[model samples]
Each structure stands twice: as C-alpha cells, then as structure tokens.
Target: MRIDAHHHVWQIARGDYGWRTPQLAPIYRDFGVEDLAPLLAAAGIGGTILVQAAPSEAETDFLLQVAAASETIRGVVGWTDFDAPDAAARIDELAEQPLLVGLRPMVQDLADDDWLLRPHLAAPLAAMARHGLVFDALVLPRHLPRLIRLCRRHPELAVVLDHCAKPPLKGGDLSSWRADIAELAQSPNVVCKISGLATEAAPGWTVADLRRAVDHVRDCYGAARLLWGSDWPVVNLAGDYALWFAAADALFADLADAERAAVFGGNAARVYLRRRGRGGSRR
Candidate 1:
C-alpha cells in the first residue's frame, strides 16, 4: 500500500498553526482532508499519515477524532510533552487508539539547545518505546548529534528524521548536513522523509534543484530507510501535494519500480507496521 507518511490538517479559524503568517497567506487558509482526498486519489496514494501541526494537546484529541472518521488517514503523529512526568501515563491513555502511530516534540522551536539528549528527557523517551509509539524528529541538521545520542539511549524507538533533517539546500552548504545525515542513517532505528525538499530548496526551484536534495537523502539512507510525505498545507508553501509528488516522480526515476515502491510506500508500512491496502499484505 502506498502511504504518504506525513501531512498536516488544520482549520485557520481555530487559533492554531501560528506558523501561518502573512508571508504564507496565499495558501495559509483552512485545509482539511476533504481538500486532500481527491488529490491523494489522483496521485494513486492509498492512504496518508495525518501529522499534528497544532502546538497543543487539545489539537491531539481533535486530530484523533479526525483520523477515526477518515479512512484515507490510516495513522496519526500527534504531539505530547515528552518531558512531562505524566507523559507515560498520558501516552498509555492514547494507546487505546490504534491509529496514533507516533508523537512529535516540535524540535524546530525547542529551547533545550541539546534538548533531544538531556537526562531530564529520558523518562518520556523511554515512555515512548514502552508505549510503542514512534518519535518523529522535526529537526534541523545541527541537531544531529543530539538526536544520535537520544536514539542510542532509546534504540527501540522508531525515530523518523523529518524533511531530510531540513537541510539548507538553497544556500548550498551541504557538507555538515551530509555528514550528520550519514551518521544518523547508520543507526537502524532512524528513517527519513524523502519529502519537503522543494520547500527547503529555493522557491521557484527547478526539478533539478529539488532533485539534488532528494538525491542526497536517497544516497545516504537508501530507499529502504526513506519514506514519502505530502506535507499538504505545509508543502503548499512551495507547491501543492500534486506538485510535490510530481517532483518525487522525477527524482525517483532512476530506481526500478520496486525500489521506488519502497520509498514511495513500502517503507511507510514497515515503520508503523500498517496492513497494506493491497490484499492485506504485511511488510
């Protein structure tokens, strides 16, 4: 089953998604599964993993409700205070819902400097593994060492590196980013999103420009360790789901259909261990 493992849902009227600013106003309006359903169908995508963008627990419950009703949204990556002493108990409560595949800590805006590896963060990290939820790291390349340490400490947690660690591709200094990614990929526990590179590259970026960033991740992590994300409303900052998926087609062209299948969908099934929509096949 082909799964777009990462995408977000939000309602502009809902006082959430503060990242939607005037700069992003063009597409910064309301976007929900209704808007994306036909697009996913057009792309031949079987389902998607609805990721949380709201910075609140209320939003997590709302997302869960949304997932329960949307057949195409097969999984969800919600948010939680991983450092909260009650986090494990909270996650246990959430675990009753099977579609809650993981949690994201908003690594892009954290203040811990080395937050991912702090000793104080250990209990929640351990809690994630104990509860069988993945940790989706929304980080920049500079956070690689912190992530490596944290992942080593909790090796059982399935940690996904979102946005190819969101490289500074447009600026073209990939040396440190490349090195860090290669190091992180060495850990079998880590998987990467082979999505959102167009936004990481300069706006108005050509197919070739976007391909460079995709190639770097593919080369470093290999297709088996990489997965796809539409990024939906977020990807709209550069392009829509259709445009981003088009870029992926051009970039993933070198691989055999089977290999591309892994990056496009197979790896997603393995990560969350979802039943592929195609004949109940298991990864």
Candidate 2:
C-alpha cells in the first residue's frame, strides 16, 4: 500500500488549535477525510497516517474517533501531556485503541528547546517504548542534538524526525542542520520524514530549491529510513498536494522503484502498524 505517512485533519471550531489563526487563512478552515481522500486517490496513495494538530488529549480522542470510522486512515499520531503524572496510564489507555500509533509534543512551539529532555519525561517515554509507540519529533534544526540524546536515552523508542528537523532551507547556512541530521541518523532506531520542506523554503520554491536538503537526508538516513509525507492542507500554504507530491517524485527520480515504495509506503507499515510488546498487527 502506498502511504502518505504524515498529514492532518481538523475541525475549525474545535478551539484547541491555538496556533491556527486567521493569519494562516489558506489552511485555517476545516479539513477532514472527505476533503483529503480525493487528493490521495489522485496521487495514487492508498492510505495515510493522520497526525494531530492540537495539543490536547481531547483532540487525540477526536482523531481516534475519526480513524475508527475511516477506511483510509491507517494510523494516528496524537498528542498528550507527556509531563502528566498519569502519562504512562494515559498512554496505556490510548494504546488500547489500535489506531493510536505515535505521540508528538509540539516541541517546536515550546519556549524551552530542551524541554523534551526533562527527567520527568522518562516514565512516559518508557511507557511508549513498552507499547511500541513512535516518538514523532516535531522539532527544528536546533533541537537535533537534544533529540540525538533522547534517542540514546531511549534506544528502544522508535523516533521519526519530522520534516528532516524542518531544515533551514528558508534562511541561514544548512551546514549546522546537515551535520546534526547526520549524527541523529546514526541512531538506528530513528527514522526521518521528507515532509514539510516546501513550507520551510522561500515561497514559490521549485524542486531544485529543495534538492540539497533532500539529497543530504537521503545520504544520511538512506531511502529505507526516510518516509514520504505531504503534510497536506499545511502543504497548501506552499503548494497543493499534487505540487508537493510531484516535486517529491522528481527529487526521488533516481531511486530504484523498491526504494521509492519503501519511502512511500512500506516503511510506514512496518513502523506504525506493527505493535511491539503487544505482539500483533495494529490493523
């Protein structure tokens, strides 16, 4: 199955999405499975991993409900208060829902870049590892070193680095981003997503504008460790789904078909759908 490994669906009135303001008018409206299914079909994508856009467990529950009712949503990356005292119990509860595959804390939005490394997070993180849940690192270039440390601390936890740490393609030198990403990739348990690059680039970006970062990530993580995601609706701010998908295809043109398949689908199935400790398919 060809998979778009990352994307989001939301209702505007949910009110938990504090970041979704009028400024992001292009994507500030509601987006649901009905809105995305046609685009997925148009791109020949068979399924998708629905990701959370808000920080509350309420939104996670909302997403789980959506996944339960949708055939195309294979898994969900939800959010929860990792620092909550009952975090482990909460994860255990969420894990009971088969579609819950991962968790993201919106690290990039926090004032403290090092917030994820807090000692309190250890227990919740351990629970995630115990359940075979993925740690979706929604971070920036500056967070890579800390992320590397986290990966070391929880070697068993599957970490998916979102958008190649949101490379600094829009501004400053990429030397720092490149070096840190290379180090992060050395952790075999971590995987990287080639998503959201278009929005990180200067507006009206072409395939060439993103090639350097894409090539660097491919070289560091290899095709097998890289998963392709559209980050749709969000992608609409830079370009539509077809535009980003086409650019991704062009950039990956030299890869063998099997390698492409892994990035587009196979890797996601292996990482998100197969539960650990539980010993069964999440599907």
Candidate 3:
C-alpha cells in the first residue's frame, strides 16, 4: 500500500497545542481524518502514519483513538513527556496500543540545541528502543549534530528523521546544513523523510526550487532510506496536499519504479510497521 509516512490530525479545542495560535490562521481550526480522507483518495494513497501535533499524552491517546477507528490510518506516532520519572513505564503503556507505531518529542521548538543529549533522556530513549517503536525526530538543522550523537548513544533505537531535519530552504546558504545531513546519514539506524520541505521553503516554491535539496538528500540517503510524506495541513501553510504530492512525484520522476515505491510506502512500512514486536529496532 502507498502510505503517507507523515501527516497530522489536530483539534483546536484540545488546548494543548500552544503553537496553534491566532497568527497561524491557515490551519487554526480542527482537522481530522475526515478532512484528509478525500485528499488521500485523490492521490491514490491507501494508508497513512498519523503523526502527533501536540506535546501532551492526551493528544497521543487522541491520535491512537482516531487510528483505531480509521481504515486508512495504518499507524500512529504519538508523544509523551520523555523526561518524566516514569517515562519507561509510560512508553510501555503507550506501546500496548496496537496502532501506536512510534513517538515524537517535537524537538524543533525547543530552545536548547543539544536537548537530545541531556542525561535524563537516556532511560526514556532506551525504553523506546526496547519497544518495537520508531522514534520520529521533529528537528531542524541545529539539532542534527546532537541527533547524530544521540543515534550513536542508542544504536539500537529505530529513528526516522522528520523533514530531512527541516533544512532552511528560506536561507540561500545550505552548506552547513548539507554537511550536517551528510554526517547524520552515516548512522546506519537513521532514516530520513522527504516531508515538510515546502513549508520550509519560500512561499510559492516549485519543483525547481526544491530540486537541489531533494537531490542532495536523495544522493545521501538513497531511495531505500528515504520515505515520502505529505505533511498535509501544515503543507497548506505553503501549498495544498495535491501541490506537495505532485511536486514530490515530479521531483522523484527519475527514480526507478521500485525506488519510488520505497520512498512512498515501502520504506515507511519497513521502518514503522514491519516488526511490531518487542525490540523491533530496524537496524
């Protein structure tokens, strides 16, 4: 099945999404599976990995509930307080949800560039590694180095890097970002997602504008390690679902059919849903 490896469902009334303020008027309201269903159908997508938008365990539970009722939601990447004293137990409990395939910490919004390296995170991360869960990294360029270090620290952890570390497409100079991405890709356990780039680029970005970054990532991670995602409503901030999907399709036109399939669905299945038993780390 062709899976949208990354996308989100949120309810404004949930009140946990502090980032969902009045200023971001485009997606300021609730968006559920019903809202995204048609878009997925039009794109010929069979399933999706429903990702978390808020930092609360309530939101994570909310996402798992949504996935439980939906046929198209193949998996869910939820969130929890990674530093909580009982984080390992919390992870064990969340892993009990059959549809819950992964967890994310929303690392991009944090003030500290090295937050992933904190000593307290060790047990929680190790717990996640123990479960057959994927670690969905929501990070930016500055966090890549620390992320690389974290990957080394937990070599058994199955990690999927969200948005190719969300490169600064708005910034013309990507030399540093490129270097970091290349270095991070060296870790065998790390996989990269080709999602959220449109939101990171200048408004009205086209295939040409995204080509260089996409090409660079393709070169570094190759098709086997790369996964495609819509980034959906957040994608609406720059362009709509069809636009980003078509753009990604066009950008990867040169790849072989099998390779393209890997990016769109196969890789995601392998990373997030393949071995869903205890200690299901991909590497």
Best by lDDT: 2
lDDT head-to-head 1 vs 2, winner: 2
Model 3 TM-score is: 0.96
- Misplaced by over 4 Å in model 1 are 274-283
**What is the lDDT, from 0 to 100, of the residue 193 in candidate 3?**
95
Top candidate when judged by TM-score against the true structure: 2
Is 1 or 3 the stronger prediction by lDDT? 3
Clashes of each: 0, 0, 0
Tens-place lDDT digits, model 1, residues 193-272: 87668788887888888766778788888978899888887887787778889888888888998989998888887786
Give one digit per residue, the lDDT tens place, for model 2 in 58-107: 99999999988988888899999987889989998888787899999999
User: 19, model 2: CA deviation in Å?
Assistant: 0.5
> Could you tell me how far off, in angstroms, the CA of residue 88 lies in candidate 2 after the best superposition?
1.3
N/CA/C clash count, model 3 = 0
Q: Clashes in model 3: which pairs?
A: none
| lDDT of residue 175 for candidate 3 | 91
Worst 10 residues of 3 by lDDT: 274-283
